[model samples]
Target: MCTFHGQPCTYLRGPLPRKRRKATDPPEYRSQPNGSGSGSVPGMTHLNLNYPHGLNMTIPLDHHDEVEYPSPELLEALSPSLAGSENLGPAHRQPSLLDGTLGLHLKTHSEYVGLTNYREPCLLDLHPPEDPHTRSVRRLDDFTIFMIHRDRETTSETQRIADLDAIEKVVHPLGASLVNLYFRIVHPSFPILHKKVFLEKYARSYHEFSPPLLAAVYLLALDWSIFDRTLSTSSWQPDQSRLEALALRTMNDDMKRPKISTLQAGLLIQQRAKNNTWTFTSQLIALSHGLGLHVDCSDWAIPEWEKGLRRRLAWALFMQDKWGALVHGKPCLIRPDEDWDVRPCRIEDFPENAADEEHDPEGSAEVVIGRELFLRHIELSLILSDVLRTFYTAKATRRNGTLEQIGTIGVAELAKPIVLMLRDWYAALPEALQLQGTRMKKLSANGSLHLSYTAIDLALHRALLRNVSAVAPPELRHAIRMGARTRLVSAMTIISNLQPEHTQSFWGFMASAQLASIGTFAGLLWATSDDDLEATFYCERVEEYLWSLRVRSQAVPFARDALRMLEAEVGGLGPVRASNLPMEMMRI
Candidate 1:
């Protein structure tokens, strides 16, 4: 078996045959005939122009297998001169004897040309004899040759070895503390890398992993370490800038041959970026495509572990593209039409260790803890992508006309189905993953899940507010206002309940911006309500939420900024109602 273009091929046994073509063969087998000439061969129904020499040949359409034949017009365009030539010869003829004049002239004139025993002077050294004791070199078979070349092309960084001494100096001292931080925080949200395989390789040798990925793991691990009381107090501090620099340098070096590690490193860098997170995420998507992460690997003859990793990474990137679009207010990169049929990830895909089995029943513990969270995240992301495609997309706006037009027709017509979908998603959540009655942790996967759920509701409610007005049937306008108000209250409640210490646990930058939008939207609702009692009630809840955010500013500074913005907007509010407010003010 051999691989071609990343797909497998098989060899079939055949015997070599000896045959010679005559110059007198039919015109169809020879060079193409000029215009109006009879070039058709007997028993042939179709003719194709063979490449390079404009040779016309009989290649019946029914007999053409696998390959797509070019059109006659295209063939003519490629070789107009040859096809139009009047004086044509048999295409299978060998080169003429008179082709090389210099060789013939030298042989005819030289005195020593016919003297076979005469030796010629030489400048280069004679070929060396092969060693008798050593194994003789044999010609490689076709499959072996292909395999060698493929390996050469795909292998990442064969020339340079990472500095083991330097890497060990950084990672070894942290011991299991770094690993704990990753599993507890990073892995729960972005489960791109396999923990068991990573730890197993790290234990064998720090050099076993790619330098960029190793450095990335340490960098992200250290970010979470600041939250760990014991680890934070240690006299020795990890150099985050140094690790990040090393990771970035190594990542650039390996750009020509991107591996799974390269994708993982890109994701880690994206998490840490303050300004260009979306730009970096887009670069990661391109790198992933280069690594064939966008192509479904289910049929590829790779290991089960690798297949699982590919599926996980592909989905992770898909989520990044979709969610990043929402966070940055940019168009999503991964369209449903362009994405491959990569399957949803499974629990068996993750590498297991003895520690994994200790949590619950032998067969299902991993599913209960990590896999469910990841699968649920994937499901929610898919819904979010659809939401963006439907309501938020430019195409949707052109079709639905302005927000007032959409509201005139009833925003609930578009929003009702999505609200049901969101409810169903929440309903289907596993008991362990549910937010209700669950004690929120500083970095709980369940808490992140709750935040995501609330974010979607906030996005939908904000969309409805785009055209909520008295002109749009009274009932529809009232429903839109009430829905927006209720969702705003719910979002504020979730944000207010989050403890100050847990602020860092939320996904960075994007989550902060999303929380800020929620607060701003709540302020808009409170400012626009006509009823004094209702306005006052929402005002107090908004103030309470702002107070909570103010106390948590040390952990979430963006939230603090959001609170200040909301206070300024609320302070300027008068009798001006939500229906009368500018559409821009109501926008999320």
Candidate 2:
């Protein structure tokens, strides 16, 4: 954090802009960052190309406003023949970028940088995280909000009492059971909070924790009351509205002095606040950057354990940003090239590990599986980022930030390397992570992990299908259609394997949104099929998936809703063909 007043700021002993890849590390992705020659973050260049402080909007409407309006010039580049004057050469062939904007240029990942926006309340560092508050506090509106302090109606001591009273009123008498339920069921899959640290603090006193965070913990745990037999049968239920209101109020106040707990609370409560999906996620990312969560903390002069916790939290947010973008049809808040610089997490980074299971009584084999599930999710988020970057970027398009793409890029060529990456990822997946067969009795991460893969693959294939044109290379169009179908069928396979146990896992928390996506994939296959026999096969499998959802309808949240979506998606597909031949679909 030391800066020379006379000169441009430089780290005396701090880590580099971002971490670089080492020789020992496996080269998972070969695509390199396109613009910057070196992988270093915008350290001095930002100073050289200095401009007024950047302002991030309080509302997540920046990307929303970047709608591309076609001018005559762009119209020609995207559809030259449509201009009625330009020649449709090899480069400007029909079914150009218009077919399906399928183009990818990738870059290899670098080493992990230290914390960028991490704000340690009291501790000072000789070599602190590279990204400090000064460096990341770019957005004017955000900084303005951060600076504004409201007039208080009461003294600090009185406010603290009031906050505690509010929390105590909402918290259950057997809050310990609820906390235990969270660790047992949810923590394994989503390890945003350090179990040891959280338990230690709660044991000391509820007041030891932030008000928002404390309320958030109990509130989230209550969602799974059924898991606790006693809580399930009890006549009393929590006042969810009150707890949520208190969390929201305290959350706003806590932002004045942000901490890791703030992020933990934000991520936990993200599920309940369905109305604020886009704005809330955007705010979380902004807060994280300001707190330096995006910076690598490998070389930070912090406790080794804290470093591990930081890495876990950082990746958790990373997963949130990538998935949120795809689900909401919004742009990702974090950028891989300049924004990310952390090393891939190792087994030691995760709080729960196999060796620790034997030492603690509460620790079980589930902890071991849960950590594996979490790590795998982080890896999948990396792949999903590439999918968004490679195929969905504005590299080939004329506009900088618009979603409306206009390019003549090779869609099939772009998919090959990513396709290989996905294949290798699945091949390298640990056998322990592989769950029981379809409809297996036990529930591990099998369904969530499998379905996640299907969703991402569907994204890749679906993009290709959109580019399918009569004038496009027949082979390319045919291949894209088949790949999409394969992904649709993959969705069915994952859906069939789902059990009641999965509904309680981390993925289960977001099941409603994901279930809608599954329906979309099935619908894409059903609506786009030119062949009647092939369409029938998709319809039958989708119906089977509907039946599966119906069986789990009572136990799972929004299962009935998903079932209805699938019914509407396939039922309204198109004119029903005469019941003639099932062989049209039976053929592989």
Model 1 / residue 510 / CA error / Å: 3.0
**TM-score to native of every candidate shown:** 0.66, 0.68
lDDT of 1 by residue, 1-588 (tens): 244366543323221221223456553333211111233222221112222322323221112242234455654686564343323323322222112111111011111111132321120012111441211111112111000011134333343244434554665567456655665566755778765445433433454556667777777778666655546778887776767777777767655455567777777766663533777788888777545566555544333456677788889788778878987888888886666557777776665433543432111213234556777878888888877876687755654565456564555677778889999989877776755433334344455567777887777776676556656777777877887877876787776666433455535335666666776676767656757666666667666777777777766655666666666655444444555657566553
Candidate 2, 399-423: lDDT as tens digits: 4323223321366667778889888
Residue runs of model 2 more than 4 Å from their true location after superposition: 1-157, 272-276, 355-365, 394-409, 437-443, 508-510, 531-541, 564-571, 576-588
lDDT of each: 0.56, 0.58
The regions of model 1 sitting more than 4 angstroms off are 1-172, 226-233, 273-276, 353-367, 398-407, 436-443, 499-509, 526-541, 555-588
Clash count list over all predictions: 0, 24
For model 1, the local distance difference test gives 0.56
Cα RMSD of predicted structure 1 = 23.1
